[model samples]
Target: MPAALADGVVTRIPTSRKVVALTFDGGAGSQGAASILSTLRSQGVPASFFVTGEFATANPALVRQMAAVGPVGNHTWDHPHLTSLSDTAVRTELSRAESAVRAATGRTPRPFFRFPFGEYSTRTLALVHASGYGAVGWTTDSLGWKGTSGGQSVDSVVARVLAGRTPGQVVLMHVGANPDDGTTLDAAALPRVIAGYRAAGYGFTTLDALR
Candidate 1:
């Protein structure tokens, strides 16, 4: 299959197989990391993780644990909007994040990266590629990071993900809590989402497949 690239970023896995890629972004507090990991393990599912340099540095053990199970991608140094920074700054962000993840897991986060906040530009894309990484974007955003106060619930999160069900679908979730409410809606809704997808006859995959 030809890899799907939208503006030089992978928005889906680009396969004809009935599979979905589950991915989590780690930029802040990892209130949901443990639950997400446990659920994935219990279900024997493969998922991807994108972590900021700060997050990786602060949660080395958890990062290593994630790396043990699935591929870990870079999410930049301070979760900055790459388009807002110069080429040099963008490269630095990628380098710093890569260094942090390597230090934590003894593995390079090469060939896989996700834009912080999903923000990027044409120039930024070239910068990312030159830095030896491919940017990944989601086909379906769970929106669980919005929390209850933001009018998102566990059930809603499940529904949203299932609503976008498709072959090679990439589902976006966050491993951190909603800053305003401290709710981990994605983690809370994960088991049901997995079950729902299984019932719908979809298998799980990780970004590593892109390699």
Candidate 2:
């Protein structure tokens, strides 16, 4: 199940489109952030960004730039695993990130949150619901965090996303400073990923649309 619908969480939109939402987590590194936004704009693609509060504050300009391009969601203060934190801690994380996003973008984020590692509990889910945000997870992950030298092979990443994708799929990638793990494949593979999806007749949307 996509993160939006996991644990039977529901959205206001009816799930009836051959559309998928592409989401990038963390990172607002100067050059990398510019490149990602440039690529998306040039390709006419829109994405959802789940940004950490620290990242948003560090790169307020980039956050505004991204928000101008598409929807931005809270990815928590430091990208901690919400399920491991107590309920009060989890709420604090969500609240702090939400505050940062609102301060940077001048608009409150939509009801969208992605767990740091897709790890959550019933209590976390309920808190997310109570916070009025939909919990989002990915159906197809590009695994771009693993910064393999050959990992960015456009053909392979495209193949993976296209091979397993279904309507309403949520695709996950990253925009943070390259992970020590070989997952930076996302940045290198991004262009091809977008092209392949377009070729496959899949329209891209933000998580707000997914919801």
Candidate 3:
């Protein structure tokens, strides 16, 4: 049975295929955005990008590129931890981000939502569910945001995802939102990650498929 959250949203997968989803979050940088998109395009891999409203507005071209290849989900306006915000604030964040993505891509994304930093309360989940968005959390984390030597290593990240991830897994990564962080490492690791997964007989899917 699928795991149902507040407001009747289901989180678990309904299928049994040996496929997982790759999702990038918070894309607004020029070089980092271009590099990641190009890598995915070159590899013929599709990924979901959970973008903040502000970032989408600032980098509309990047948003269009992401949407052109795969699905673009809402990641809030400023990447705030939705757990700490009121319901009204949560709505604003999601609505603004959805609007920006639609304006940039001219396509409305499916009802998918990834909470920034994976911080969400029951109330936040309820709000998201009521708003018709499925709350997406990862099954395997690359820890690419940590900036540790291990986290910055592409081989290490790919190995972790390939070894631990199973069907319907959502592999979490970032697209250079934090200036002081190691999102560059994520960009570097992407090609290896895709190759590793493909070699392991796993096909990538967007978050909409999971829903």
CA lDDT for candidate 2: 0.75
Report the alpha-carbon TM-score of model 2 versus the true structure: 0.86
Which predicted model would earn the best TM-score? Answer: 1
Give, for candidate 3, the lowest lDDT window spanning 10 residues: 1-10
Poorest stretch of ten by lDDT in candidate 1? 1-10
Q: In model 1, what is the error at residue 110, expressed in angstroms?
A: 0.8
Which order, best to worst by lDDT?
A: 1, 3, 2
Which sections of candidate 1 miss by over 4 Å?
1-7
Tens digit per residue, CA lDDT, model 1, 75-184: 99999878889888998999999999999999998878899888888899988887778889999999999999999999999999999999999999999999999999
TM-score of each: 0.96, 0.86, 0.87
Which lDDT tens digits does candidate 3 get at residues 1-211? Answer: 1133223333334457878788888744544678889999988888888888898899988899999888898888888777878889899988998899898999765477788878887788778877778777777777665545444566676777777768778788877734564346677788888878888788878766754
Q: For residues 1-211, what per-residue lDDT tens digits would candidate 2 score against the true structure?
A: 2454445443223456777777788743433577788889988888888888998989899899899788898889888878889889998998999999999999877577777778877888888877877777778877555545535454576677777667777788777544454344566677888777778788888776654
Q: Kindly state the number of residue pairs that clash in model 3.
A: 0
The lDDT for every candidate, in the order shown, is 0.91, 0.75, 0.76
Q: Which stretches of candidate 3 lie above 4 Å from their native place? A: 1-12, 27-31, 148-151, 181-183
Model 2 segments more than 4 A misplaced: 1-16, 27-31, 149-154, 181-183
Backbone clashes, each candidate: 0, 10, 0
